[model samples]
Target: MARKRLLLAALAGVCVWGQAVPDSPGPAVGARVPGFDLADQTGQSRNLHSLFGPKGLMLVFFRSADW
Candidate 1:
């Protein structure tokens, strides 16, 4: 039946993905992080270079926008 085939496909996909390695970027020590472009609360796209020059850069990822 189609339901059995779908269930088997899902299980096979899960098994394949489960065997993959985890992502571990490790800790940062006196490192100059890479810059990324993202939009602000005003829905405007802003690049990191506009905020900091090529000499220095820092990134802060918070859980909530209130942070």
Candidate 2:
């Protein structure tokens, strides 16, 4: 009985860890995205609110500069 309980606990831990967490979020099937803040090309600060101001925004992520 003790060995059975231990095996069940180990299996439960493995199952939990195997579950996936999304690397990206939002727009599951064409949804409006929320505003966010980030930096600009020239080292200047930028934000979605400032760019949109009363409009909407879109974002695309890519790999560059070893990032």
Best TM-score among the predictions, by candidate number? 1
lDDT of model number 1: 0.67
Model 1 stretches astray by more than 4 angstroms: 1-27, 53-59
Clashes of each: 0, 0
The 0-to-1 C-alpha lDDT of every candidate, in the order given, reads 0.67, 0.65
lDDT for model 2 comes to: 0.65
* Residue-wise C-alpha lDDT for candidate 1, range 1-67, written one tens digit per residue: 8767866866786788775533324344556666678888789988877777667656666569574
**Alpha-carbon error at 43 in model 1, in Å?**
1.3
Candidate 2, run of 10 with poorest lDDT: 20-29
Clashing pairs in 1: none
The RMSD of every model to the true structure, in order and in angstroms, is 14.5, 12.8
> What is the alpha-carbon RMSD of candidate 1 to the true structure?
14.5
